[model samples]
Target chain A: MSHSVDTWIMALLTLCVFSFLYRDNPFYRFAEHLFVGAAAGYLLAVQYQNVLVPNMIRPLGRGNLLPLVPLALGIMLLGRLAEKTSSASRWALAFYVGIYSGIAVPAYMQAQIFAQLADATKPWQPGWGAINSALILIGFLTVLAYFFFSAPHRGLHGASARVGIWFLMVAFGASFGYTVMARVSLLIARVQFLLRDWLGVLPGA
Target chain B: MDEALDVRWFDPNRINLLVGLSLFILFLFVNLRRARRAPSGLYIRTLPALQALDEAIGRATEMGRPVLYLPGLGDMSEVGTLAAVTISSRVARRVADMGCGLLVPCYDPVVAVLIDSATREAYTQAGRLDSYRSGTVQYVAAAQFAYVAAVTGLMLRERPAANVYMGSWYAESLFLAETGNETGAIQIAGCDQVTQLPFFVCSCDYTLLGEELYAASAYLGREPVQLATITAQDWAKILAAIVVVAAVVATFFGYTDIDKLLKTS
Candidate 1:
């Protein structure tokens, strides 16, 4: 009995969320506010448990001083919301930027440029590796040629980027198809609700 | 009447089932009244979103301004990036033809290069190969706020007449939209961020909601088969909703055997 009642209450909550689609009625507004409050409350609780307690309060309580670094950094991030003290936030920003840039800039060059171009170039080695590599190289070169912006398009760079146009077209086409699948899946999930869950009719029925 | 059993209301599956059924019913009404088209037939239609390039480019030409297009925050895995590229292809062609400037600031380097190519190729395709600007498409830092700052700086420096935003967006959606708004540009935006839809609606002149972003090329390109697929997907939605409602009803009212039989089949 309780199981079914629980199902009903959950249904009611979900229905409240979906109600927004019909021009934001009172029920939908209620649901939206409830959701916002719940989300905020949950975030506060999680941050307290995960970051504050373990990373800050616990350390200070246990006489561990090293945790103060992260504790101070976290506090500085809050300075961004304040007007006068916002300049102090830059120290945190610069710290993050330095660490992030250190990791990202090199990773991008090595991964996107060096690795992709290398793999694209070394197509004809010895075995199937040669075949796949050749294909990748051809595709990359053609696409690169299609976008060749630096030099005038009188010769090979011009021709390669033109081939790049075809590769780009194919990529866009595949992306389009996949996007449709995703949209259809969401629509299907919603529609399935109305059918099996609400009406309770199916193959067996 | 056991309180312990009452706590079962928080069960994820039970909640999901009820919620699903409710939404399915709601969409049934939402889709039923709109238009009547055959399921299998194809219809080609044009949306002004494509013409937006012509307008944006024409404005840039008239005002001697640049056009700024940002491919959202996500990398290539995002559908928004692909949509932005397709739109950029058209915009680049127009900008090339009009002899106006184009600026594309991208979050992802891979996507930036691709967008740059798409922009350059648009010029090449338009026979304005000489007009294709190498500096037109460039990468900004990948961090969310850093990318936003970089894009905002470009908008301020260039002072574009028209801003086009297409792709996956999150927290930075409003930041970009609001910045574009401040610049007094005619902003045309499309995104799949359901949470950010309201922001776009409030800030942008033309906003594509939810699945509309995915249907952009088809609507803008006026492709018949693509339109047909869109219709099929709509019908598929109806079919899915009916199934959900049925599942919920079976799961309720002590019809466990019926639900099991339906599931097995």
Candidate 2:
């Protein structure tokens, strides 16, 4: 076993989290609560030091009037604490939503829609690559048809949509398999830490 | 002067995007006016997950168990989070009308505030403001895994009958869904995150894939303007498909001008 106190604490906490797989128990609960509390507290501290201090407080302190706008919005967000002032919070929410939507609308259009369409339209390579390109175009068109909510799915549109559903399901299946592999890797890492770091029993250790 | 140093006020490369956006807004305005004039003519296909919202709340009410809602891991700036909150408002209104308990644990503090306000407003609209509990919405941990752990713990302890998850999700999607599944709750999950949809589809009773989550607000609200926006989006997609096919045909004929025009930088 490791002689270091920190290492022992880390191992025990790791085991406590792992204990959740068996069932919820006191050890797991203790670790969970500790993690939650520490995370929240750490987040508050970090936000205060890194975000509020640098972005808001320091700017305002330096006589920059620009930070006042966000400060006012932040204060308005706090209006939810009371019944009478709660409606004022909507303004802050509206401002936030408007800003984000304005920023995202053009970005999404450029990146997702136009850029993707441009790439898809590029000339196909020779031989087998042309077939692959054709398949991609078909998939893109079918999926687009499937997502066409304005039109009723009937006849040719319905057939294309059915093909689109198959494409979506196959994509989802591949993604699921890939993610499951990632999760298994995470588990292996935890096991490796237990054996190699804590007990010093692994080959490298 | 060098061409590189000739900085203009606007980027010519993004003209296509500007034109596209302008066309979309024109469609939106035209549709909105039309829908306002004749609201009854609009048709929207049924979304199974949205249709189940009432059933989920009813089940929770019948079982005398609270309904748990997680508004995702995103803050207010995310469109997914905004849509989730809008749907949550409708859910809250229904839960209030049915006299069932509602619990919303939030990842972002700002989102928690917004949800809390929205829920209260929903209660007011339902004429059940007296039944509204201040503790219905809460700020959980800001950290992702910590928030998941807390929610899973709540799921086990409360054993809520219905779990509604919406908004932008990450790895915690499976953790939350699987835990709710274990508790035998009827779970409804919706997210725009492509990678996380598979996990939700596997675990949840109903999953809203991609744009369905965005469309939930319009579907639930049934407002002319919102529905008009959906129609406008469909028109934009149709236009995009046409452009794609035309560009492909043009490139195949050795005419690369269309492809170059569409390129953004």
Candidate 3:
């Protein structure tokens, strides 16, 4: 088997993370802190290179004034560091939230609402497919009815919402199952690494 | 003038979308205006999970321990952040009145500031401004695992009696809840994440499902604008159901025009 500094470090970090299953300890804390510090440092460098230098500094350097609007907002955001000046952050927050809400309105309406409705309205094909289409329609309506709290869920609304709960449970069950499978897959990969790459207990290479 | 440089304000292919958007907005405005003039006594079915929030807070107050709210680990710009802070404000108000300690460990510095201000404002509004502590709303850690580690440690050491988890969560949902459970805390969690729902459902004493999280906020706030918007959303859903049923019938008899009408570029 071959060995390298990178490989050893990888094994050590992996083991450190895995050790949390048993109990939290100094080694785990060291790895966790190191990970956070590394991430923060990387984020700082990326922000400078990708955002600050390029978007803000260069545009101003090229004699464009529009970037100043965002630069000013960024500066105002930093005002949050001090209590006396923190109120200035509200202007930035308001602008950010207002813009986001405006953009999200049309975007959400188009994609989530209209597009979904359009798809739901697809022509029902015949045979067993027709039955499936009907079920989908029922499921969609019931689930939607479940979310519709403007009308009290009683009588028909109550019945439909109950049905919706069943559908939602099924959906959640499937999602939960999928997530479990994903975690299991990760466990398998880690175990395979420990055996094959680290210990060379299996055939390969 | 290059034809290639020509920019159209409205794309012809999405005329259907333009019409749909217009109608929806018009409907929302009409409902909003009507609601403003006279609240329709908006019927929101009782959610046990939301009710549990008060009970959980009360339990912490009774136990003489802090109530911890972990608003998931997302960027400050997301809708979840807004929801978190909104709920945090509500909780802070209640905490001030009850004289119970509140813990809000923020992931983003910007959000830390927002929530701190929000909590302070809530405390002031409750006329208990002196009780507000800035340390409760400070940033914990930025990295996901680091945040989880720090929170887990907090749960072990602080041993909050009631833990409220909300907003958009990831893999760390269970991590926090399991740790909170070890402390024998009464936990209530809410989120729109489908995958994390199961974990919350299993671990949390009461869990608010998807869409219900937003509904809970609107319910708690009961602000006119939010109520009207929620009413519009319900109407939209009803309209969608109608459309779905009609389209299914139309298609069963062989209709293609509806499909074409919805197509976009």
- For residues B151-184, could you state the per-residue lDDT of candidate 1 as single tens digits? 6656766789999888888877877888788889
Name the best candidate (by DockQ): 2
Which residue runs does candidate 1 get wrong by more than 4 Å?
A1-205, B1-41, B44-53, B223-225, B245-265
The DockQ figures for the candidates are 0.01, 0.67, 0.55
TM-score of each: 0.45, 0.95, 0.91
Q: Which of the CAPRI classes, incorrect, acceptable, medium or high, describes model 1?
A: incorrect
Clashing pairs in 2: none
- Candidate with top lDDT is 2
| Runs with alpha carbons beyond 4 Å of true place in candidate 2 | B1-9
Query: Candidate 1's residue-wise lDDT over A75-150, tens digit each?
Result: 7856745658766765765575456545553343344333433233221445666576456556754554433222
Best-to-worst ranking by DockQ: 2, 3, 1
Q: Write down the TM-score of model 1's second chain.
A: 0.74
Model 3 spans > 4 angstroms off = A1-3, A203-205, B1-7, B38-40
